[model samples]
Target: MARRGQRQSGATRPAPQRRRPARDADGLLPVLARAVREVESAVERSDVRPSVRTKFQVVALLVREERSRVNADHTSSDAYRAEQLRRLDGIATILAKSAARETTLLGLLAEDAVISEAAASLKREMLIAAGQEPPREEPVSRPTTPADTTVRRVVPQTVVQRQLANPFLAPDFSSAPARPPRPGRLAGWELITPLLRSFEHAAASASKALPEPTTLRTAEGLELMPHQARLIASAAAGHRTFLLADEPGLGKTAQALLAARAVGAYPLLVVVPNVVKTNWAREAGLWTPKRNATVIHGDGETVDGFADIVIVNYEVLDRHVGWLGDLGFRGMVVDEAHFIKNKKSQRSRNVLQLSERIRTRAGRPLLMALTGTPLINDIEDFTAIWEFLGWIDETGPRAELMESLEETDLTPADPGFSAAARARVIDMGIVRRRKVDVAADIPARRIADLPVELDGAIGRSIRDAERELADRLVARYETALATRTSGSTVDGIDHDLVRRVAGWERSDRDSAKTGENVFSLVRRIGRAKAGLAADYAAQLAHSVGKVVFFARHIEVLDAAEELFTERGIRFSSIRGDQSRTTRQKNIDAFVNDPDVSIAVCSLLTAGVGLNLQVASNVVLAELSWTNAEQTQAIDRVHRIGQAEPVTAWRIIAAQTIDTKIADLIDAKAGLAATALDGSDDEVAASADFQLEALVALLTNALSE
Candidate 1:
């Protein structure tokens, strides 16, 4: 039964048949073979123009399409099929080499990269030249939104009065940036994608080259830490924009307010989270007393029309975005800038629009996007942050960045372009300093996870809720897969679609309200873990003298306080709703009063402004959505004046969503570590982590 090409023996068979290179006489193979060679030569010569990149992508796409066609052709003989695949592999090898030579071309090979019309048109021509009609191409539809996507927008009467009072303060286009008369060297090479990927492979120190510290410039007896002073000096030296991403508890608020003062960015506008809105005014007075500060509350009825610094929270920003944009504020600061990572969200749009207005109005405003979490989820997080700082825009690098790349004297086709590009971007005022970088100025801190298994009925409910959420996610995923019209079926789990479905569940108000969501599930987990966290806190209180317990929900706080009372332990309660005096009084009691062993604090309120270095031991009853939040809570005790090394006891529920979120946060922490600390760990995935808990864990354990 042996075939003509093979002969069988008792112990041995004829040598396996060799796969000869198939002739490219009659198919798309000839066109792709020629195209790949062209691409290779173009890249080798450092002439990888946009058209050349398009050809490379087309050749790669056609090779894959033809290989699939050859393997699935029932009429073709097996020998012919094998030879065809071998030839296709040869073409693929050339494409790989070209990508290696011009690394920026590698982005076009990614699965998520959209196929441009040029590439599609090129593919059609190649297939037509092979005497076959090409199929019609359908455009990929992304989630779209309206221009004014926010639910509502309003201008307060006081804002209108302020604007009327300053009628001469019309927008000053004289200072707006003019477009370059001619295109730069690397004009149309899709530099944004390459620039973003630059960070993923980054190893250089994250911060910009800062000037040495100047003398402390505060009006009061307040003094700046050395690292803080260096950044202020950079601003004083006329650096306009900064992605000031020092780790939490590094006093970013002080730096920002003082930076505005250094530049005399009067009529400064600061957009921050609601929890820290009041603290901005307080810190402004403390750091730069010469500058008057006012916080805009509901409708901004009491907002000082002529204050030197105007502060507004993100929640009410929608109402004020109108007038804020109209006002000619010389400087703008977005605190917790990560909140605007999702560019489609109303808040993100508002922030971007205001930044644009500021750029247009002021010649060169002092724009600072302050966030300790350099990346909350993924490398793409840099897009919005960069746009807010006027580095890059929707299409590609704006004028300033384009000019920097031009000075590199290397195209995307040239060797070492990515690194050079990253360095240029860093030079554009990415001031990242970790606490470890200033460890001499501050004590060392560590976060340790304590896995606690939930065994009782409460645990059962949490597990059940978690299962329900997972099932819903899976069902949605399957439905999406089945209904997908685009014939692009992936081999395994489509993590992109899973992320999309999870985002829909989280953002779609109707669906999120109807079913059990991640928020409810997390709250349930926190409620269930209250007693266990309290017990651990009680133990720590006895051992370490004073322990700070942080919880997100009031019910969890009440339960912890009840447990402490049953054990007859004295504790102080601090909450978001508490008045300033009351909150401070409780904090004073916990700090000065030795008998108060634990301070039951709200993670949202007490996490930011309070100085609880009196306690070295801290217990977390609930997990936060972002690493920065968790770090903020722990940093309440990890700041200056800590006598010993700090430890954060993260009470993670084993085999639950709690553990997944913990790992995700840990992965995101690598962004700051690598970008800021210049450590070995690479940056993690996008912040849109929801259903890929298992995927995250595996990626964390394995190399990319």
Candidate 2:
């Protein structure tokens, strides 16, 4: 009897009965419908001027609408419910514009705002549909439909009235002449005095704790060796702070850490090149006292917790400035400060900016830059680096020192310009220590300049290229100058015209221009570089010890590799493409293994922070503009740990642009000390771009 209706219903009904669909208290369909309506209304009102209240109202209403719809249905579809909630979230994000005032909210709004708005809109819609108008709005304000109430949170018309002034943005009510900018030392006395006092206290404690130096002094507690202690003490006391420019294997990192610690500067920040970040961290743990030192990089925890020492690589420092500002870092150790010599580089600019912002509860923080080659073979390199370390002298010996160096000679008992410059610069607190001068265990360096003449055939070809290149360069220069000088009434000449002008120029060199016929000159230089590499390969074959060759051109690198390969010379190259891990591995094999004879590298990749004491020979296939660059390459073998004499051979193509460049580099190297001493004037006069030198080489070759 019971089965009779069931069988009939099965036959007549919509198919056989399947499982009943699941339902929420509020059906998914209603919530989704409500969410869609709110989105539509918000989009229509999107033209309203953006404000915090308007943004908040928009988001809140959307979320409330979603919640109401979800809560109302006894039966709902899962897909419909999920979609409605997602839509409600999106609505909340539009409303979040109200919460963002000072900080950028683009990412936060994109990620989280939408979800919140959807929920609110859904709830608001459901309530309105149930004949429950929210308390805040009057009867007239009530929404026409349940979905309209979902949009009630956002009141576009009353946005201005709802907005409130943030206290942080309020103007300071009290003013007392705003303390007119103070004078030197005194101008910052209020800030500097306390910091100096704190530094003094740290210095005293370090001295008291340090044990007396003896032959076995290094055996004592975590204290520095006597010589190292002296360097640290000097660096810690200076106003200009110190540039610990010690060669590799001389423990530059150790010296910097000890200097900071001796001054009771616990919250010290160290910035190094990317490759050395891990080394610095590990070194800190082994050498420094038991304290929290965090390395900020890749998957590392956010430095929310306090740390005694914070080590970061140059690549990552720009991203974590806020953390640094909050820490009130009292001391900064720029381990490879040379990385910032280019003012345009982010690390250099960022560190300089940080120097401007670093203020403790006590005063402005101290800066310490550590690099072996402060001058890097160029006088301007010193200027670039010294300015970064706060070594400016407006009226003192540093300024007068620059004036004296311009004359280029010295008289008896005059305490020459270089001396005065050193005193003034040193007074500001930039200390430069040389391993050869101070550390005796370090081996002596033997350097030689090898000048070679190209064969007549190649030389003549190179000369022809130079003439063609120079003509084009001059024409290009004149055209550019002409266009720049032309009044705005006339449209400027195009690059093609400039090239034509350069091609037509009669002179082989242009004094006013930096580069000449780039295409021809590049080709000429390329040939010369190849010829020089062949010459270097011939010379290196005779060398006994393992040799490290630093090349500036990839052409030279390839040419040299060919020579090595053809001659069966076992060699390894560490160039830019190799990962840091691979680079280190290759360098280690070259330095440590007797079977491997040579390590070829690019000047840029192996320029700094490398230890190559195992080899006694360094060869530069081409010259760089900066002396420090050459010195760093040379120092790879000449560093403190080398036991044998370090020999450096620079292969120069005589009477070419190579020779001219080498001459300028040599001239600049002589002025590096004075320049570093904070005197730039005389240093500027000694070095000049000599287009005539290039022309003479060209003319001589043409005559040949």
Alpha carbon RMSD to native, model 2: 29.9
Per residue, candidate 2 scores C-alpha lDDT tens digits across 1-704 of 24423432443234245332223355433444444444434434432222322333443543675568766754888777677667655554433322221111222232122333333433444444444443332223332343332122221211122123222322222222212232332221122212122222221111112223343222236545455666665644543266665544356777777667656665788887543565576667767747668776522344423568878765456446544544556778887666565554445666776664552231434567776553323334444455545543222212222333323343222444334334334444445544444455443775556555443456666656555555545444555666665554324434444433433443444532644443345345545656455434433433244778888777778877766654457777888889989988888898777877778888877888788777766778877657778888898878887866666777666545666666767767767776888866476554432433443333344334
lDDT of 1 by residue, 1-704 (tens): 14312211211223354332333458777878888999888876767666787788788888888877887798989999899999998898788767644544655675545566556656656765676656644252232233322122556676678778888886656565757624867866888888888778576667789888758646666877888888889998978999988765567888998899888888899998654565577778778888889888656777887788999877567667887887789999998787787676556888999999988888789999998665323778769989999988888888888888889988888879988998899899988876556767754787756666564467778888776666676777678889999989777667677667766666766655556777778888898888778866875675447889999999999999977876679999999999989988999999999999999999988889889999877898898877788889988998887766677878777778888898788978776666677666544545555545534433333222
C-alpha local distance difference test of each model: 0.76, 0.52
Off by over 4 Å in 1: 1-152, 172-176, 375-377, 443-554, 557-704
Question: Where is model 2 more than 4 Å wrong at Cα?
Answer: 1-225, 235-240, 299-304, 359-364, 374-376, 393-418, 438-598, 601-704
Which pairs clash (backbone N, Cα, C closer than 3 Å) in model 1? 377-686, 377-687, 378-685, 378-686, 378-687
